[model samples]
Target chain A: MTTGAKRPKRQTAKRTPPKAPPPWDPSIVVFACNWCSYAGADTAGVSRIQHQPHFRMIRVMCSGRIQPGFVLRAFEKGADGVLVSGCHFGDCHYIFGNERAVEQFEKTKEVVKLLGLEEGRLRLEWISAAEGVRFAQVINEFTDQVRTLGPSPWNGKRQQSVGRAAGQRPTTES
Target chain B: MPELAEAAKKTKAWACYDCGKCTATCPIARVGGSYSPRRHVLATNLGQQREIVENNTLFTCLTCSLCDRRCPAQVTYTELVRDLRELSHGHGVEPECPHGGALQSVMRMMAKGGTQQNRMGWLSQDLKTESAKGQVFYWTGCTMYYDAFFPEFQVKTLEGTRSAVRLMNKLGINPVVSPDERCCGHDLLWNGDRKSFELLAEHNVKLVANSGAELLVTSCAECLRTWKVDYEPFFGAKPPRIVHVTEYLAEHLPDLKFDTDRAAGTGPDGDGSRGPVRVTYQDPCRLGRHLGIYFAPRQLLEALPGVELSEMRRSEAAAICCAGGTWSNCDRFAKQIQVERLREARATGAQVLVTACPKCQVHFRCAMKDPNLGGEIEIEMRDVVELVDQAVGQK
Candidate 1:
C-alpha cells in the first residue's frame, strides 16, 4: 500500500452483555383453615407424603378469616402465589364459614386478577382433615404452576426499593 | 411535637381566631359526632400533641375543605387535618378503615409496584387507547379495584371510565392508557400514609414522564385532586396538564353532537316525547371545594339535549361530602350523612342523581341499600360521563 493511502479501520467486535440468569424458587403463601386444610397438611406430614416445600402456611381459624386484605397483603409483601384452602362447603366447623369463604375468595380472585397477576397464581380449594394425598397433590401442582410462571414481578429489586422508599425494612425472605 | 408545630404553621392552623365556622360547616360535626374541626385546630394551636394523637377523631375528618371555604381567617382546616394525620400515622397509629382495610391494602400494594396490572380488562373493543405513548394520558385510578371490591353495590365503576374513553375517541383523540399506571395515592395521602403515597406519586410521575403526555385526564375527582395538588412536589418543574373528564368534555362541547332523539325517553317516565329529564347534580368535594370546578359538569349536563339540571339546596361550594371519604370512619355518622344527602336529591324531584365521582355513587348506593331506609333514598345515581355517553350515542 502507498504511504498516502488511508488504512481501513479495524472492526471492533460488538460486546454482547450476558443474559440474566433465570429466576428460580417462587415463594407462595397458603392460608389454611385450622379445621381442615391445616390438619390435612399435618396429616400429609405424618404420612411422609413428599411435596413442594416452597409454600409457608398461615393457619387461620377458618378460611372466612382470610379477607381480601390478607391475600393482597401477601402479594404486596412479595408472594409469588396465594392458596386459600378451607373445608368443603358443608363441612366447615362453623357450618357457613366455608360458604362465606367462597364469597371472600371470589372477591380476592377478582382483585388479584385485576392487579395483573396470573389467574393460576391464586387458587381456592376444599380439603377435609383426612385428605393427606390431596394436600400433597395441591402443593406439588401449585408449586409447579408457580415455577412455570417464574419469580413474581412483585418480588426482587423493585419490591425492595418500594420497601426502602416506604421507610420499612426490606424483607429478608425471597 | 416539632412536626406538629411545623404542620400547624404550614397549614395556617395558627389563624383559627377561635371561630367556630369550621365546626359549623363540618358535615361530620353536624351529624352529631364529637369530631370537631375547631377542637382539632385548638389542640394543634395549643400544642396538645398527646390529645391530637390519642383522639380517633383525627381520622374522621373527611378533608372535604368545605370549612376552608367558610373560614374567614383563611385557615386550611382540611390540610391541617391531613398534616395532623401524617403526624399521627408516623407514631404507628392507624385509621380504623372501613372494609377491613382491604381497599387500603390494595392502594399500598399498588405503591409497592412491580406487578403488571391488568387494568385494561374493562377496555371494551370500541374504546380506543394508545398502547405506549401519546399526547393525552388517561388515568383509570383504582376503579378496577373498586369494582371488584364492592360487587355487592352492583355499581359498574369501569363503565364511567370506558365511557370517558369513548368520549375521547369521539373527539378523534386516542389517549394513552398505561397498564403500568398505579394509584394516584389520594386516599393514601389523606390516610396519612405519606411514605406509601410518595412511592405511588413517584411511580405515577415517572410513568407519565415516560409516556411524554401533554395532557392527563382522569374520571375520578379524587384522582384529579391527587395528581393536580398532592403530586405537585414530586413532579418537580414539568407536570402534565391535568383535567377532570367533565372539564375536558365541556371544553369540546361545541364539537360534540348528542342524538336528542335517543336521549328523549331516558327519564323515569317512559313517555318517549315528553319534557327533558330532570336530573340533580351532587358536587363532589374534590371537584368543587378543592379544585373550584363548580360549572364544568353543569355546563356539560346543560348541553345535553334532553337533560335538565336541578340544583340541590347544598350546591357548589356549599355542597356536602359523600360522608365516607378515603374509606375511613364509615360509621353511623357517615351513614346518616349519606342518607341526608340522598334525601336532598330525592327532594329535588329529580329522576336521576348525577355525580362526577365514582366514590360518591358507591357511598350513595350503599346508603340506599340500608334495610331500614326502605328505598326512601333510592334515586338512580349516574356519573356525568355515563349520561354524556348515553346522549352521544354509540359509534
Candidate 2:
C-alpha cells in the first residue's frame, strides 16, 4: 500500500535547459487515521483496487489529531490536494474521534477557501477500515480534481507569490 | 424617578450639591442635551418625577462612570441612573430605540427559550475550532448576527471572531468555541429586563459550563463585562474566568511577533504593509471604566513593530462611549458622539482606529454613512483581535 513511488522515466526528445524540469502530475497528501483509513489503504492493495498513484499517505492514531497547521504545511510543502479520511461516524475506535475529525475538517475547509485555495484541493471523507474500494475511488476522484488545478502554487520557488511567502513565514518575535 | 429617589439617597444620588462638575465632565451634557447628569440628579432628587420621566432623559446616560470619578460627594451617579431607569420601566415609560428597536427585539427574542441559531456560519474554512471540549472557550456573543444585520457598515465584524480563533491557534491552544453561544444579556439587563436577562444568562452559563472550559475569552466588551461582573449575581457563585482578547494577547505578547515579511511599508490604507501603521484606540466603555481594563489592549498594540499606538483625546477612563450600543439606544446624540470620536481619532494622525468592541466599529461606520458630512471617514476602524491576527500573519 505505498503510493507516490517514483516511476520509470519516460523517453523524451532532448530538450533545452529552459524546458520543464519534470513531468506534470498531481501531488496529493492523504491523512489517514491509524485505526481506519490507513488500514483501508492496505485493504485497497490486498484487493488490488485500481486507483491513481498520486497519493502520499501519513498515518495518525486518530484523524482528530490533524490540525489546520498540518494541512497548511502540506500545501506549503507543495501539495496540490489533501485527502482526510477517517472512520465513519459512530464507528470510530476512539468513540468520538471521527466526529471531532468531521468538525475540524469542516473548520479547516473554510480556512483553506479563505486562503484562496480552491475548494477542490481539500476533501474529507469517512472510509472505514474495510472500505478499500471506497478509498481507491476517493483517491482517484481527488486526483482528477487536483489535476485540473495543475501544480500547487507552493510547488517551488518558481511558483512562490508574495502572499504565499508571507503566509508561510508568519513573523514571531526573536 | 420618584420610586428610585429613596434608593438614590441610599446610593448618595441625593447628595448632589449642584456643583455641576458632573455636568462639565459629561459627554452627553457637552453635546447640549437636557439629560445632563447634574440636571438629572437635581431633578430626580427634587422629586421632579413627572418632568424627568416625561422627558425620557434617563436613557441618554451611557453609564460610563466618568462623573463618579470626580464627584466630590461620591454620589455614585451611574448607579443612580440605573435605578432610575428601572423605575422608569416600572412606570411603563421607555426611551425610544433606534433601528426601530430591531436589535433590541432580537435580544428579547433570544431571551426566550428554544430558539435555534446558525451562529457558526461565520466560521471561515481554515480556522481551527473545538466543540465544548477544549480548555479555552471563546464567547463570540451576538457578533455573528450583528455582522449580518449591519453589512452596510462594510465592516467584517466577525473577522474579529475568526482572527481570535487563529490567534488562539498560534498560541497553541485549541479553543472550545461554539457558535451556539447566546447573547451575554448585557443590553437586556442594562435596559431593565431582569427576567429576559436571566433567561439568556441561564442558557449561556449552562452552555459554557458544560464545555468544561475553566477559562472563557471574548472579543466583545459587553460580553466581557457581563462575564466579569454580571455573571455572578444571575448565575450565582464565580463563573469561569473570562478574559478579553486584548488581555489574552497582551499576556502572550512576549510570545508573539509582528510579521516582518508582511510589512510592505504602510501603503495607502490597510495595504497589508508593515509600515509602522499608526493606530488610535477607541476605549469601549464596558471594557474600560465598566471593567477597569485599559492597559491590556495598549500592550498588545505596542508589541507590533510596525504598529504605533496613538492616543485619542478622550481615552482610557475618560473615553466616550460609542453611544449607539447599550439597549440599542441609538439616537442623534449617539451619532454625534461617534462622529466626534472619529474626528478625535483622525486628529491624532493615526491611520486606523482600534477598538475591542464590534459595535464601536458599527456605530462609527454607520455615522460616517451620512453623505452630508464634510468628508468620508479618513481613518479606518479595526478590532484589536484583527490587529493581533495580522501581526501573527493571519488574515
Candidate 3:
C-alpha cells in the first residue's frame, strides 16, 4: 500500500493504553433533619457503629427546610453523593415535616437525575431517631455505591479545572 | 443549533411515547381536540422547522402545564411550547400582540437598563409606605400600569397594592416600595423573549439588591414566582427572599389584630359583624401549582371574620390558568376559558371572586362585563389583600 494511504492489516498486536481509574474515595454531604435523622446520625456515632467517615452533615430543623438548592449546593461543592434523611413518614416531630420532604423529593430527584448525576448519587430516606444501626448501614452502602460512580461531574474540585480555559488560573473554591 | 439541542433536552421533546395522553388531557385540545400537543411533538420530532415556528398553535398554548402534568411519558410540554416560542421568535414569526403591542412594548422598554417608571402613581399619601430603605420591600409589580392599560375593565388592580401596604402598615411593619421597579419579566420569558427577560431580571435584581431589603414581598403571585424561581437560578447569587404577600402576611398572622367586631355588616345575618360573605378564590396558577402556595391565600380568608372561603372545583394544583396569562396567546379560547371559569365561580354562590393576581382580576372583570354573557355571571372580583385591608380598617 502507498504510504499514508490505508494501513489497517494487523489485528493481533493491540497496544491498549491503560485506563486510569476514577478517584474511588467519594466525598459525601448529608443533610440530616434535627428531629430524627440528625439524632439517628448521633446515635450511630455514639453506638460505635461502623460506617464511612467521609460525609459532612448539616443539621436542618426539619426535613421540610431542606430545599433543592441546598442539595445542589452540596453537589456543586464537590460532593460525590448527597443523602437527605428525615423522620419516618408519620413519625415526623413536626407532624408532616417528612411529608413535605417527600413531596419535594419527587421534583428534586427528577432534576438531580437529569443533570447526569445518577439517581443513586442523590438519595432521600426516612430514618428514625432510634435507627442508629440502619443509619450506619445506609452510610456504608451509599459510600460504596458512590465509590463505584467515581467523582461527580459537578464536584467543585474537578469543575474548577475542567472549566478553566488554557492559561487561566484555576478557581479557588475547592 | 445549540439552542435547539438545549431546548430538546429541556423539554424532552425527543421522548416520544406517541400515546397522545398529553393531547387527551390538554385544556386547549379539550376545547377543540384539533391542533393536538401530540401533533406538535410529532412535528418537533420530524424537524418541521417552518411549520413549528409559523403555525398558529405555537401562540395558542396557555402554557398551563396540564399536558406536561398529564403526560405519561413525563415530557415537559410546557417547556416545549416555550422553546417553540423562542424558535418562532428566532424565525420572526411572532403572533399579533393583544393590545396593539402596547403592553409588550412597555415591558420591553423597562428592560433597557435604566428607564424611570412612575410605577408608584397608585400609592396614596394616606397609606404608610417606607422609602427604598426598609428591610422588607413591597413589589407592586406593574399594578398601576395594568390599571392604565385596562381602564375599560375598571379593574382597580392598584387597590391590591394599596391594601397590602395598608395591612402591612397596620401591622406596624413599614415596607420599602419603589417607583423604579419594572416588570418582573414573567410574560417575556414564557413568550420566548429571553433577551428581554434577562435584561428585566438583572435590572430588577440589582434594584432590589441596592435597596438593601432583606426580604422582597409581593402581592402579585406571578411576580413572586418569577422572582423566586427564574431570577434566583439565573442570578447565581443568593437572591433576597421573595414571598407572596399572603404567605408573608399569613406567616406573621399570629400577632394580627383580627378585631371581629368590625365585620358585623359582612356577616350572613344581613350584617357584616359575624356572618360570613360567600367567596370563592381563583388560585393563580403561578401561586398554586408553580409555587405550591395553595393554602396561604385561603388561610387568610378562612381566618378573616365574616368571610366564608369556598373552594372552586378546579382549585389548587388543578387550577385553571388565567385567561390573560401570555399576551402572545391571546385568542377567543382565552376569553372563553375566562367566561366559563366565571360561571363556575358564580355557581358556588360566591358573591365576590377573590384572586391574588392582577391579571386574573383584569381578565375576569373583562369577561364579566362582556355583552355576550348578558350580565348573567354577576360576580365582584376583589383581591384578597383588599379584603384584608378592609378587615384592618374602614379605609
Candidate 4:
C-alpha cells in the first residue's frame, strides 16, 4: 500500500512531450490511379513495407485522369517531384485509360524539360495492382531522382520582388 | 484485313487497368449518355469485346487525352481508344454525336485533302507550302489552317519557325517545308474514321519520306504526338526524327538572342507595383502531360525579362482540359469544360496565360467566351512561341 501511494508525489514533475521531426520539404506527390496503381500502393502499406516518408498519394480514377496541371500544381505547391503510376499497358481498370495517360505523360515530360526542372521532377510509370514492390521501387527511385534535382529552380526563381529578371519570379505559397 | 491483326498485335491495349478516369474526364461523356469511356474500358478489358465495339462510347471519345492526363497507369487511353475506334469503324460500327452530323462534314473535308489547303488560312493571300526539297519536312496539321481564328498566331509561329530553321541552317541543319503535306491523321484517328486516318498517315509519312527530309518538324502538339506514337507503331521502323518547334528552340536557346524592347514592356501601371504582372501558364494536355515537355516553355517564360510567372492550381501533370482538341467542340458540354478551365486559369491572377500548343490557345479562347466565366476575368492568352516571337524581333 505504501508503494502504490508513492506515485501521487510526482505531480510537480510535469514532463513536456518531445516535438516531432521537421516536415520534409519539396514533398513528393504521387497520384496513383486506382485499380492498378492504387491497389499496388495499398499492398505496399499492408505489407508493412518502408518507403520514403516524402511521398504523398492522391488516388485517382486512372493515371489518364491525371492532368498536366495537377503535376504543375504540385510543383507550384512546393513539391519537388510528382509521380504518376498506373497499370501497365493494356492493364488499366478502364480499358485504354492508360493509353491516354501515356500520351499526356509524353507531353508533360516536355513541359518539365521546358520548366528547367531537373529531368525526373515529373515521372510516369505503369504499376499493376499486384506490383506492390514495383510501386515501392518507383517511389524510391523517383524520390531519389527528385532529391538530386534539389528544390525546383522555380521554387527560388519565382520572384516576388520587382526589378528581378522575369525568370526569377519569387516563389509564392502554392 | 490489311494486316489489321498483325498491326493490332503490336498495340499495348491488352494491359488496360479499367479505372474509368478517362470516362470521368471525357468531355463527350458529360453530354451524351450514349457513351461511357469507363464502361467501354471495362468491357474491353473483360473481353466483352462486342459491347466495346458495338456501343457508341467508342466513337464519342474526343480522344483529347484529358482522361489520359489524369490516368495513373500511363496507359495511353486516348491512343488505345483510337485504335479500338479504328477497329470498330473497320468492323462497321458508327459513332453517335450531338453535332447532328457535323462531324461527318469535317470527315469529308479530311478525305478530300481540304484540310491541307486550309492549313494557312491565316495568310493574307494564298500561301503555298514549299517542298522540303531534300531537307526537314515541317508538318502543319489541320488546326493551323482551317481554324481561321488563330491567324496571327499561325503566321507569327510560321515566321519564328522559319527563322529557327534558318538558324539551324547556320548551324549546319537544313529543314524543308512540304507543299503537298497532308494532315497528320489526328482528327481522322480520334474521330473514329480509321480508313481516313490510315490514308492520311500513309500519305503524310510517304510525303515526308519522299521529301527527302531527315527529320519531321511540326508546330502542332497533336501532330507531333501522333507521328511519334501512332505512326511510329504502325511502321515498326523509326520514322523520321520528329521535333516540335519549341524543342528545336530550347536546343538552340544559347545561340539565340532577343530584343528586350520587343519582348519586355513597362506595365500599364507604369509604377510597376506588381511583380512582373502575374502571368499564369497552362500546359496543353498533349504538350505538357503527353509529351512531358513542361519546363521548356517555363524556361522560355522565365527567360523573358521582368516577367512574373505564376501557375494555375493545376498545371503540368494536372493541367485541366480546355476541351478544344479531339473533337470536344462537337460535344454540348464543351462550353462548360472551357468555362471551368478558364476559371482555373484566371484564379492564378495572371494577366496573361501562356501555352505552347496552338490548339490550347484556341480552346482557351473558346472557354473564355462563355458569359459565365469569360466576363468574370479578362486574361490574354498567348502561345509560348508567340511570346517568344514578341520577345524576339517581330520577324
For model 4 the local lDDT of residue B248 reads: 70
Error of 1 at B196 (Å): 2.1
- lDDT at B210, model 4: 70
Please compute DockQ, using alpha carbons, for every candidate against the native two-chain complex: 0.45, 0.01, 0.01, 0.01
lDDT per model vs. reference? 0.86, 0.76, 0.76, 0.62
Ten contiguous residues minimizing lDDT sum, candidate 3 chain B: B264-273
| Docking level for model 4 | incorrect
- Chain A TM-score of model 2 comes to 0.77
Better of 1 and 4 by DockQ: 1
Measured with C-alpha atoms, the lDDT of residue B133 in candidate 4 is 70
Tens digit of per-residue lDDT, candidate 2, span A1-174 = 478778766544344344434444567899999998999999988888887786789999999887655675677566788988889888889999987777667756654543445788999988988999888888877887777666666565334332221111112211
**lDDT by residue for model 2 (B1-395), tens:** 34756866767977778999998888777887666788778877888877766777778887778888779999888777777776677778665665545455556545553324557777777778897787889888777666655655686788888889888888888888775677788887777666778888888888888888888999999899888887876553546788998898888887786675564355325555655778899999888887889999998887775788889887898898888657546667777777888889889989888999997888888887877885656567788888778767742
Model 4 alpha-carbon drift over 4 Å, by segment = A1-174, B1-36, B64-76, B91-130, B149-175, B233-238, B266-277, B372-374
lDDT per residue (tens digit) for residues B293-364 in model 3: 888999999988778888888887777877667777667777777877888898898878999999899888
Candidate 3's C-alpha runs over 4 A off are A1-174, B267-274
Clashes of 3: 13
TM-score of 4: 0.57
Q: Please state the error at residue A24 of candidate 3 in Å.
A: 71
Name the docking class for model 1: acceptable
Candidate 4 structure quality by residue, lDDT tens digits, B1-395: 33233333443444556667766666656654355666655555556667666655565555556776566665566666766776777677765443333334334334444222323333333223444576666666554332332332232334434444444444455556654666676766776676777777777777777776777777778888888877874663546787877787677676667666534554423444534556778777777677787787788777766677888887777777666566524455666666667777788777777766766766566555556543784467666665555555533
A1-174 per-residue lDDT for model 4 (tens digits): 755655467655557564343322456888988798889888877876666666788998988877655665566555678888888887777889898887667655544443335666888888888777887778777766765555554454223322322222122211
In model 1, the clashing pairs are none
Which stretch of 10 consecutive residues in model 4 chain B shows the poorest summed lDDT?
B146-155
